[model samples]
Target: MNIVVIDYGSGNLRSAAKAFAHAADEAGMAAEVLVSADPARILAADRLVLPGQGAFADCRAGLDGADGLAEALTEAVTTRGTPFFGICVGMQLLATSGFEHRVTPGLDWIGGRVEALAPSDPALKIPHMGWNALDFEPGRHPVLAGVEPGAHVYFVHSYAMTVDDPAHLLATADYGGRVTAIVGRDNLIGTQFHPEKSQAVGQRLIAGFLRWRP
Candidate 1:
């Protein structure tokens, strides 16, 4: 199977590829992972994985100049019905717009704003990092089947998705208040947390994505 990870000059591409490679190996599936900025390559992908780091607004800007990448991605996922998996700031880009810096608009596939997780507890940190449990909401799909409600997944982000629709949210993590950790709407799946850094639970999540079919 072919999985294309979009390299938009935003984050570390190899790490995401390594994680997918490991998951595919464990799942006994022969998979080829490619990190390409070419829009044609991205459009032809069976599965599209968008992994990102750095500022949300900046990432959006980079994608905007990616020579039809933004349009291709939208068509690939929406029209051609290709499964999309997004990570970290990549997940936030799936929303309508983000308020990280100067209110940048996203792909608008899901309606939400990327906001900082509120810190009610004085002892809590701002950017929720390290290992945290994923609390599965309800109505589990194949992409999240074996992953239990309270499974720990690695995360490192300052902004979290404030999704409008409850049906889009698959799981949440307790940063301070319920911060969106995972979102799955139709063929699109997005994770605010980094599955690459998230060990076994993360691997299983990736495995599920490979096996998941709509």
Candidate 2:
């Protein structure tokens, strides 16, 4: 499969690319990992991976004004039903808005806001970094096929998504309280955790994404 990794000028594209490449190799699938800012290249791919880091506002600004790149992506994923996946800040961008510094509007593909993960305890860290266990919601989804409920995945985010439709949420994690970790609806899937950095479990998740069907 041809996997196009979107390079929107602010993301851990290299790590994501490496992870997908390694997973595809192990899974015996022909996958081409490309870091392209060009929207056409992204549109041409069988599947697209959107990876992100840094500020939400900056990333949104970069993506929105990407000289047709963002528009093409929205069309490809939302309109044409091309498979799309978002990671970390990329997942944040999928929300309706975010309040990091100010209220920044997001892609709004899913109805939600990227809000800070409020710890149930006062002493818990803000970013909620390190290995955290995922609680995948009951039922089947190709991306979480081999991934277990309560399985640990790497996480590093101060902000987390709160999707309006509970049906859109595929998985959650308990940091201090229940935290949304993975989301899937139709052809789109997103994760706040870093599968690329999650080692074996991470590879399995990516492989499942590769194996996902509409």
Candidate 3:
């Protein structure tokens, strides 16, 4: 399988690439993972991973700035049905729009909006950093195959995706209230947290993603 990790100038590309590589090795899959901004390479990928580490609008701009890269991604994932994995701000981009700094349009693959986390409690931090437990939905999708409920995962974001459709939400975490942890619809999946930095749990998720057919 040819896995492409998009380098849109706003992601921890090296860590993500290394994590995916380790997962591919552990899964014993014949996979070639590449970190590239080239549109042709992205279009040729069997599976696509988009990682982002900044503001929603900034990430969107970075993606759109790449000549034909956004269009290629849309064609490959939406038209060609290539499996897609979006992390952090990459996941936020899956929303219809975001409300950070302004109302910015997103990829709209998922019916949702990215909004700032309004914790019920005043003491909770803005960036919901550190580790938290996952509450997987019953009969979760294949991308979370071996992942268990209550499994700890690392997170580092202030805003979260508020999905319009409840079924699209695969897992959630508690941060003064419920926060979207994982989401999926058909061939696309996303995580609000940094799975690459989530240690063993992250590795298992990565491995599951590599073996996932849909």
- Candidate 1 on 1-214: residue-level lDDT in tens? 8899998888868999999988999999999999988878877888899998989889998888888888888888999989999999999999998888678898888888887677678688877889998888444778987688899988888888888899888888887678899887889999999989888888999999998897
TM-scores for all predictions: 0.96, 0.97, 0.98
Question: lDDT values of the candidates?
Answer: 0.88, 0.88, 0.93
Q: Write the per-residue lDDT of candidate 2 for residues 111-165, one digit (tens) a residue.
A: 8988878998999988899998988754558789888887899999998899999
- What would the per-residue lDDT of candidate 3 be over residues 1-214, giving only the tens digit for each residue? 8999998898599899999999888888888889998989988998899999989999999999988899999999999999999999999999999999999999999999999999999999999999999998645888787788899999999999999999899999999999999988999999999999999999999998888887
Q: Rank candidates, lDDT, best first.
A: 3, 2, 1
Clash pairs (backbone) in predicted model 3: none
Worst 10 residues of 3 by lDDT: 137-146
TM-score of 2: 0.97
In candidate 2, how many Å is residue 139 off?
Answer: 3.1
Which scores greater on lDDT, model 1 or model 3? Answer: 3
